[model samples]
Target: MENKNIIITGTSRGIGFELALQFADAGHQVLAISRKMPKSLMEHSNITCLSIDISDENEMEQVEKFVKDSWSNKVDVLINNAGLLVNKPFEQLTTSDFEQVYKVNVFAVAALTQVCIPFMKKGSHVVTISSMGGIQGSMKFPGLAAYSSSKGAVITLFELLAEEYKESGIAFNVLALGAVNTEMLQEAFPGYEAPLSAKEMANYIFDFSLNGNKYYNGKVLQVSSTTP
Candidate 1:
């Protein structure tokens, strides 16, 4: 993976940060995009941090252009790892919450993937960060409709993208995480315990990215602490 150009979103912190560091440690040139860059990551030699909001259309265009021009229009791997969550009853959930969640989780992924398709070479991979709530109904939780539905849509997007790009040699998949001890989770469910660390989740994603196969493409992987 040395010299490979990898692009990841939401790298300011949490799982995205861990993934960026892991790839950089492995000698890959990383382009980390987020709204902000942590001071600790400013000194990473292998990483180039770009501050851009994925939810903004114009910013996304600029990011796409910068990536293409700087990287010679080539991206080895693209990871759509940015997401949002809102908790409240249906009646209490405002319209802005729905729009914001969908914009970040669903719209951004679709737009970025579409723009990245032409830049990706054969054997390149795209990974989306989804949630286990995407697979099953989250009746136990309140006000998860917007988030869960967006994840479900993300899974569907990956399915269509995998089939559409089958001959193109660009693999696409979604990692449906159970509970990662990330800020997003903490913000959504305060006091949640026994969650996976960003490094643990990053490792899982790293392995999958290296070993992506036909069977995994378009498939939603439900990651949890206990599995059969």
Candidate 2:
């Protein structure tokens, strides 16, 4: 494939980090966004690291500017992979906790996608990382009221966006992942070993983001091997 301009959020570690490295290694230009820039990503010539809180609206403008000035107003793929998880019992969870999680998981995804839409042309793909917990009929867990709900919200958001933008020929899809042994997972379920590693899941997402649009649109794929 020819070199494409790709943007991914939450690249400081885990699947986001692996996705950035994998795409860059494949000769694609990558704009990796995270709260902190990873040293390894900085060393890669194909990757450009941006340290900015996605929840901050003012800071998000920087992404648009970069796309216009640096990427020359072109974005082939956008991965909304940055997510915030708050693990607290329903009784103990505060309103602030819900806001915090939604700010990053739902609002940021919407904001970032809006900013990049102008630059994304026909055949471009927007992939949002969701959780199986977000699915309506999927199993639910304790202490995930806020986190799981926010993931579900984004799933619906992307589905609506896909239909709204169908005429534009840009595809929007959601991947509801089960477990992938990332830092977030450890926090949610301590000592639980996931069957898939970060790199393994990233590899799947990498390919899906590139070609899944051709076969599916406004759809949610359940990427999981285990229950809960």
Candidate 3:
């Protein structure tokens, strides 16, 4: 495969971090965005680390400018991997909690995609990382009302976008991930061992982001070996 310009959010750690490294190792030019910058990502010659809160409009504009100025207004792949999860019971969850989770998980995905679409051409793929909890009829979890609902919202959002942009040939898809042994997972399910590690899940996402579009568009693939 030819080297392509890729943008991935939430690269500070976990699956996002692994994805950044994997893409860079594969000779892709990567723009890694996260609220916190990891030194390892910065040290990579093939990766550019941007420390910014994706929920902030100003910070998102900076990403647009960087793409326009540095990437020659071209983006081959965009991975919306940043997510915020608030583990609180529905009764205890405050409005602020919902806003915070939605800001990062749902709104930020839409905001970043809106800005990057113009730079993408035919064959470009936009992959949004979601959670299995978001899928209807899937096993529901407690204390994930905000997080799971936000994930579900993005799934529908991208499905709509895929159809709207079908003529443009830019593929949009969502991957509803199951339990992965990441920090986030630890927070949600303490002491429960996940069958998959961060690196393992990242490898799957890395390959899907590159080639899944050829077979699917506006589709949600449940990428889990076990139920959450």
TM-scores across all candidates? 0.93, 0.99, 0.99
- C-alpha lDDT of all candidate models, in order: 0.84, 0.95, 0.95
lDDT tens digits, residue span 26-136, model 3:
999999999898898999999998899999977898899999899999999999999998998899999999999999999889999999999999999999999999998
Question: Model 1 lDDT vs. the true structure?
Answer: 0.84
Candidate 2 lDDT tens digits, 25-75: 999999999999889999999999999999998999999989988989999
| After superposition, candidate 2 runs with Cα above 4 Å error | none
Candidate 1's error at 115, in angstroms? 1.6
Question: What's the lDDT of the predicted structure labeled candidate 3?
Answer: 0.95
* Alpha carbon RMSD to native, model 2: 0.6
Please provide, for model 1 over 59-105, each residue's C-alpha lDDT reduced to its tens digit, 9 standing for 90 to 100: 87876787778889988889999888887788888889999999999
Error of model 1, residue 30, in angstroms? 0.8
Q: TM-score of predicted model 2? A: 0.99
lDDT of 3 at 179: 92
**Steric collisions counted per model:** 0, 0, 0
